[model samples]
Target chain A: MASNLPVPVAESGDIDLVLRQVLQDVLGLSSERVAELDAESGLFGHLPELDSMAVAGLLTEIEDRLDILIEDDEVDGEMLETFGGLITFLSDKRSDA
Target chain B: MPMAALAGNWPNPPHADEYAVSFDSGRAVRLLIVPALFDEANKLRHFTVEVMRALDRAGIDAMLPDLPGTNESCEELAGQSLPSWHAAMEAAARHFRATHLLTMRGGAICAPTGLPCLRYAPVSGVKLLRTLLRAQVVSDREAGRDTSREQLLENGREDGLALAGYSLSPEMVRQLEDAELAAQDLPDIAQSELGGPGLWLRAEPDHDAAQTVALARIVAERLA
Candidate 1:
C-alpha cells in the first residue's frame, strides 16, 4: 500500500548526482576521487572501502536519497561492477518509476 | 579547549556502573547525545565526538552516555531491547541534568521524549535493521553461506540474530522491525543542512570540520 503511493520522478541528472554523492558519502571517497570515477572505473571489488558492509549502507543511502526502492533481487555484481553500470541501473529504475 | 571527562555513575535501574563522556563546564545548556546504533555507531563515533567537542567550544556542555549493552557498558547485547535503551537514556538525562537531547540516526528511536531535541538525520528502525541484515547477507554470501534477508528475519524472530557482529535479541529484532522515528515534530537536521553526505553511511569512521561547525552553530543558535 505504501509503495502504491505516488512518488516523484527523479531526473536523469538527479540520478547521476545521487549516485556520485552516495559513493562519496557511503564510501567516504573525496569529491575529487568520485569525479575521477568514469564509466569504465571499477567499483565493488575495485574500491577497498566499498566492502560488504559499506555496500549495504551505500544501497540504503541511494534508496533514501533517490526515493526509489532497490529490491535485493535487483542487486548483483553487474549493477555494481562499474560507475557507468550503476548509473545506468539507477536511471532505468527512475524512468520505470 | 574543553576536555573530555567521565561523568559520575548513573544508577540506570538494574545497571549501576555505566559511564559517559562529558564535556562539562557546568554550562546551563546541557545536551545528552544518543549515538547511532550498532555498525553505524562505529562509523559515526568520531563524528559524534567531534560534534560534542564543537559544542564544548560553543560554551555548552554535552554528555554521550553508554546505553546498556553498548560502548563501555558491561551488559550483554543479546539481553537488551529498545525499552531498555530508552530507559537508560531517560536515566542519563535525569542524572546529567540535561536540558536538551542530540539524537543521531537510529538513536532517535530511543531518545527520551519531552525534552527540546535536535535529531540529526533520524532513521527508521526498519531501515536500521535492514542495513544490518543486508550487511550480514553480503558477508554470508562472500563466505558462501547464502542466507536470505527473509530467512534471517525468521530466524531472528525465533532465536537471536547475529548481524554484522552484533548479536541482537529476538525482542530487539522484533521491535526494530516495527520501529520508526519516535520523537516527531522536533527540530531535525538533515544531511543537506550539514552541506555534505551523511557520515554514518561512510565505510570507515571519519569526520568533517564543516559538519562539526554547522551542527554546533545550529544547536547553539537553537539554545540561544
Candidate 2:
C-alpha cells in the first residue's frame, strides 16, 4: 500500500529563496535588502523591518505561499532569529508535508 | 466609489459617521467587496481599488464597503467583533443588492453562505489572529519588553488588546480564532488557473495591471 509517489521536498536553497520573496512582499522590503540577506543575516530584533506588525503579515504570507499551516503556539523567537534558521525550519516543514 | 454612512458615530458623545463604499455599475449584477481585516486592509487598498475598477471595466458592478468600527467608521474598535463585522457586511450586501461576493484574505470569514462568491487567497481566522499576536509580540520587543500570548489574552479580556495597530475586543479574538472559513463550493477561486499572481502578496503596494486585468476577466467570465 504505497501512499502515492513520495512528495518531493524543496531544497534548503530553494526554500530560502521562496521565503525571501514572501518576506520582501509582506514586509515591503526593497528587493535590494532582501537580496542582501544571507543565512547569518539577523532577523526579529535585528531587522527593524521585521517588526511586530510585519511578523504577522510575513507569517501569513509564508503560510499562503508555502501552503503550510502555522499554529499559534508553534511561533517562537528562534525561528525568526536568523535568515538561515527560518529557512531551515521552512525546509523541515515542507519535508514534513 | 459611492460612500454610505452605515453606522453613525461612536461613544455617542455627539455624532458618529461609520461609512461604507459601494462601487456601482448600475448594471444588473453587483459585487460586494469584503476587505481583508486589520493592517492587511491598508496594504491591500491599491489592489482592492484596482479590482473594483477592473470589475467596472468588465461591465460588472461592484461595491467596496468598510466594515463597522473600521476605516472611517465612527465606532470604536473596542466594541467590534467578528459577528458584528459579518452582520455589517451582510447588511451592506442587501443594501447594495449584490448578487455575488468578492472576498479576500480574512474577509472570507464574513462571506454570506447562500450567495455565490469569488474568493481570492482566502485565509482562515486563526491564521489571521496568529499573525496579529506575532505583531503584538514584535511590538513589545521593540519597546524593550517581551510579552506572551497569555498576557495578551488577559489584557484582551479586561478591555481590548491593541495588536498591529488595531484594537480588538476579546470577543472578536475568540470568535475569529474559532472561525474556520474558506470559499466552499464557490463559483470560482482566483487562482493561477485565472492567469495572475496573488496581488496581495506582491512586494510593493503598487499597482499590478496584469493581475487586475486577469481578475476582472475571471470575475466577468465565471460569475456572469
Most accurate candidate by lDDT: 1
Using DockQ as the measure, the top candidate is 1
- TM-score, model 2 to reference: 0.77
Q: State the lDDT of candidate 2 residue by residue for A1-97, as single tens digits.
A: 3334433454666677788787776555778988998889888778665566767667777886778877655667788889888887787677777
TM-score of chain A of each: 0.84, 0.79
**Candidate with the greatest TM-score versus the true structure:** 1
Query: What is the per-residue lDDT of model 2 for residues B1-224, given as tens digits with 9 covering 90 to 100?
Result: 43321322212113253455545647888888889887777767777777777777677777777777778876788787887777777777776778889897789997765678888777788777777787787667657676876678677766677887888888987887788875277644645654544545543455567777777777788786
Q: Where does candidate 1 stray beyond 4 Å?
A: A1-13, B1-4, B183-185
Interface RMSD of 2: 3.6
Tens-digit per-residue lDDT, B78-152, candidate 1: 999999999999999998899999998889999997798888888989989998888888778778787889999
| Local distance difference test, candidate 2 | 0.72
- The CAPRI quality class of candidate 2 comes to acceptable
TM-score of 1: 0.90
Worst 10 residues of 2 chain B by lDDT: B4-13
